[model samples]
Target chain A: MPKVTYRQHDGSEETLEVRAGTSLMLGALTGGVEGIEAECGGSCMCATCHVYVDEAWLDKLPKVQVLEDEMLDDTASERKPNSRLSCQIEMSDALDGIVVELPESQI
Target chain B: MATDEAAGLVVIGGSHAGHQVAIAARAAGFEGPVTVLSDERELPYQRPPLSKAYLMGKQPREALLFRPAAFYEEQGIDLRLGVSATAIDRAAHTVTCDNGTVLSYRKLVIATGTRVRPLTVPGSDLVGVHYIRTLADIDAMLAELDRVKSVVVIGGGFIGLEGAAALKTMGRDVAVVELADRLMTRGVGKTVSTFYADHHRSQGVDVRLSTGVERLEGENGQVTGVILSGGETLPADMVIVGIGVLPNQEIAEEAGVDCANGIIVDENTQTSDPDILAVGDCAQFEGRFYDGSLRLESVQNATDQARTAGATVSGEKKPYDSAPWFWSDQFDLKLQMTGITVGYDTEVIRGDVAAGEFSVFYFKGDTWLGTDTVNQPANHIASRRLLDAGYALSQAEAADEGLALKELVKAARKGG
Candidate 1:
């Protein structure tokens, strides 16, 4: 199991131990974390699950796909270099302690 | 500054799009009260999973809701479940509910969505014949799952293929009967259609192409088989119809809204009347994705239009100019498509189609039209950006397999 931490914009954080092979969005959603809308239900069609990956873990995660990047442009918040759609990031044993910060709103 | 009155913004139909309209109105600083009317008993839920996870019993009922009932209350939205807007009083700016409640609204959003197009044939109303639309329909079908050994799915559209895949996964014998020559004929090109048909057939689904279901054959008020146009009987204890859907536009039409195939709306999702707006599947508007007017039945269109409509009602006018995108999952293949492919002059295939990771890019003369990618999310995303930015790719450049599509999109953006 990979333990991921989801930090909110209001300086609150919640960590969960999610099974490998599931997505970060699924982990946050299954764990009842606020701010990740995920309206498309992990289909990569909606950009509601926008998050800012911790700078240290940015290069450690998989490369951002073009699809996820396009969706990031449509995020409610301004897109940053570290902004990623959490739904596109699949959890694995190697990435056990990754941290993601949620945006203010995922409209 | 003048204070805005506490007027009501009533949204008809509490599906995914309807819920968004209500939520967006509040999010966009609409000081008016928001009311959402739904005919279904449950709160706003994701309907896409109904044919797949929910039907397979893998997804629980609670997992279907887009947001909890508490979320609506927290947002100060008046969520009315199990009640429908029967009539729209355009002149009075009020809506009459089926429960005899008349609510006046300052702005009305019609997001009635669509209903499954019924199969009107002999024995169509037999007990085991089912249509997958709402959660109730899926639950009813699940109740008869154990008794059904074989299922004959009518249509080769997305819902039909998805339902067939789910049934096959559940160890049931399934067959997809399509009237068109290929699967997803109207949506995708011939290459994609054939690829999907072959893929579904490889997954143990009997893909019957160019076959019309003349009528259903039932015994003792229970469906037993489906009769083909050539009089061949396919033994099926269960029947799932995914032919298509018709927009629920009757209520809007009665209110004297301009409706052709669907309620015609402008770029802001505003209908013939400025106070009246339409979103989701029932709303037809001129979009940049296609040449003229188009009504998309996907969640992307629903969400996008809802945001625009909500913003417009709240005094922020944003045009619905975004390129349309859609995705469908069947068996193990995840297809992501963007833009419209109806009038492509040339087709370019990139990646290995046999390996199940390929994208077909369509172009008209020198302009990029759209793309359909199977298990190629990167290509789908890049194509959408290019289309949205009005970046055209020449036939020569799009056909080159060595050039990365993302890089091309980046270059197009820089050059444009």
Candidate 2:
């Protein structure tokens, strides 16, 4: 199990051991974590499961493709450099221990 | 003002909502540096037909592009593609970008839209599983439609049911497993859902209600079937999950704005902060439609609310008032809806439900809340005007098989 940490705006962090190959979204949902709503599952159709990767982990994840980029622009929260739709990010062994910032808002 | 002046307008997000906001801004004579930041690399496209028309090949992908690529250039919009807003420093009035670029703005419009829900159960990671929320999703499904012999749709809501119907029309075996008791329970009333379930069944769809999919069963890195909660097995070569959507308002929350089911806004779509506004599926506006509540997911809602937010940002305070409307088409059947019918006590009909052509009106205390017109465009159109006007109807007039809807609305307007 890979440990995933979510940092909310209040400077508190919730860490969960996400099963391998689980989309970071399901990991959060299954861990009973708050903030990330994997609405629409991870279809890139809805941007509800939005999160911001710590700048350090941005390079570790898969590159944001055209479709994912397209949907991110539509997010209601203020778009940012670290912003990512958590549904598109899958948990892998390489990300054994990673930290992501919870979106301050999830519409 | 020319491009040199930088229209002083910042629109972050470019789809149905953002584009409309930009166009409305230009229409309102704000001639400064009108910048539109679009994260979608494929230009501005609408997602309305991703499940039906586009899947059926009745509409081209380019047709779905909200506006021509040239329209942005001609309008002198600094429409940046493949770029996203990284952060909003409201105190500094700047929008930071991923590429180390920061845009200074006098005002900003955040029309970030919604996404399709992803399937979360085990084996959802398998290949050939898709969501009908974007053009890419449709492209993959349409390409696989020819090869896939069967499909398992996880939800029987409008998107799931419509996509299942379309796939089934292509001669594929489709199993629509819905957690809800009926189809489109949120959009239309229960009676109308029954009519659609029967309609879908008569058309050869396996309509499974009150059934929940526990997991996707896969083999060889591909979807094989879905396991039901009751230990039933559904064979399938592919799966399309259309559970629903949630608003993308993460950035707003971090900035300390109020959000409930969605970002909380007033009738004008203004959030807790006066500087920021919310719209589209990501927004929860305190609105009333018919005798029930309101918060729609159709493109109509996106554009309507976008227009209101755009105008307001431009210093025009207009109360947002647009009759909620939506449409979903399947196999020669067009299901159009007007207003929302959440808590209607009486549902009246004016056509034949069995014949696959009829209109069901939900009314509470003699006032219409909403109408679902299946294959009856005229009735749907009239229902929109009547419902928007808060027109009244008697029990006899509402269900009169011989009554003309146009005449009915006129009569209701006369205080009859």
Candidate 3:
């Protein structure tokens, strides 16, 4: 299992051991971490699961796909250089202890 | 009258809308007991992929779940799977389930959703005939996939086309029979429909428009062919019907809730009886974006309306006024649409349709109405934001491929 930490906008954090091969969105959803809507169910169709990854772990994550790059433009929150759709990130051994911050809202 | 302790929020149907109501109510600080009754034995799952990825065996069953079972238990939601609300006692504020359980509720939310409009033609009940509405339907169809070689899909709607594409990809000969003049006539405009029809044909799918399935031909109680209205019989080992859906509003209507096509709900998602509320495909309310009353059958509507109903249940009244959006994935084509394109007087095309990436911006005179984007996810999102902000792009600006929709949305927000 890979550990992931979800940091809220208010400086609150919750860490969970996500099973390998599970998406970050599903991990947060199953662990009851708030602010990640994932409304389209990990289909990269909705940008509700937008997250800002820690700069150190940014290179560890996979490159954003074309569709995801387009959808990131529609996030309710401001998209940063490290912004990514959590649904597109799958947990693995190489990406252990991933740290990501949740936006204030996911409308 | 039930005591306050015994009366809680009871939700029926247990699909996307029903599941959302329970979770949203909890999120809104509703401490009362929340019970969700679902006729399905499986946990709440996604229905959109059943015809696409699930049918193509690209997605597993576990991936279809909206939330894992533990999340519901952690939320303290009393999810009763394999149970259905048989009747509602409005005066008594109780719901009797098919499992013989009578539950009392302070507020009841009806999210019964919709069922596939069955094909009533002769031999419709034969084996190898399936409709894509429930997981069981897909499971049953999947069980027979190995034995099915040729499939005739009735209706060129989302389900039919997506299923046909999946079946074709799985090495099955597929033919789509649509009674309408074009594919997805009820949803998309003629250009999109024509494009899809051509795309499907290019992909080796026999797209039959203005063709009707008069009856089915079967042998040994199993469907073997589909007879067209023009006396042509197309050979088929399986038949998939996806004409449309009818709302499951009988329980609400039987309880004397105002019903016309679907259960009538106000802006707050309350039914005729204030204690009862309806959301999702089963609820019909006056459209904020379109004219007259309409019932939307999309995940956006279900989730948004459920959120509004949950707020009202928790004594926080918020009117439901979210713009409608939907997406369909078929054979590498991702079609995303925002707002209602009905009654559009003009349409503007952006990007190259021949390249299989473009968007059709719809407008009524000078006012922008909606947009249908094919293989253009950014435009879809930007179009939705523009619609939400009530910003109408000039036809010339919209048709200009040089102008980025994202920039337009950003400009609109900054100017507003």
Q: Compose the digit string of candidate 2's lDDT tens values, residues B1-416.
A: 11233327787788777877787777566657888887878777767667876788865665465555676777767788888877777776677777677777777777777777778899998988998877877887777777899899998888988898888887899889999888887888876789888878888999999999888888889999899989999999999989998777776776677876677777676788776777777777766573323356777778778778777777787667767878777667778788877778888887888887888888787777778888776677667767656676566777887887777666666864
Q: Compute each candidate's TM-score over C-alphas.
A: 0.90, 0.75, 0.95
**Candidate 2 local Cα displacement, residue B9, angstroms:** 2.0
Q: Which ten residues in a row have the lowest lDDT in candidate 3 chain B?
A: B1-10
TM-score of chain B of each: 0.97, 0.93, 0.97
TM-score of chain A of 2: 0.95
DockQ for each numbered candidate: 0.31, 0.01, 0.56
- At residue B190, give the lDDT of candidate 3: 84
For model 3, residues A1-107, the per-residue Cα lDDT tens digits are 78999999999999999888888998898787878888888878879999999999999888998899988987889999999999999999998998999998887
Summarize candidate 1's per-residue lDDT along B229-266 as a digit string, tens digits: 88898999999999999999999899999999899999
Computed on C-alpha atoms, the DockQ of candidate 1 is 0.31
Model 3, range B275-394, lDDT digits (tens) per residue? 999999999999657888999999999999999999999999889988799999899999999999888889899888888999999988988889999998888988888887778788
Best by lDDT: 3
**TM-score of candidate 2 to 2 decimals:** 0.75
Instruction: Summarize candidate 1's per-residue lDDT along A42-106 as a digit string, tens digits.
Output: 76777899999999899988898766766776677989999999878889998899999999888
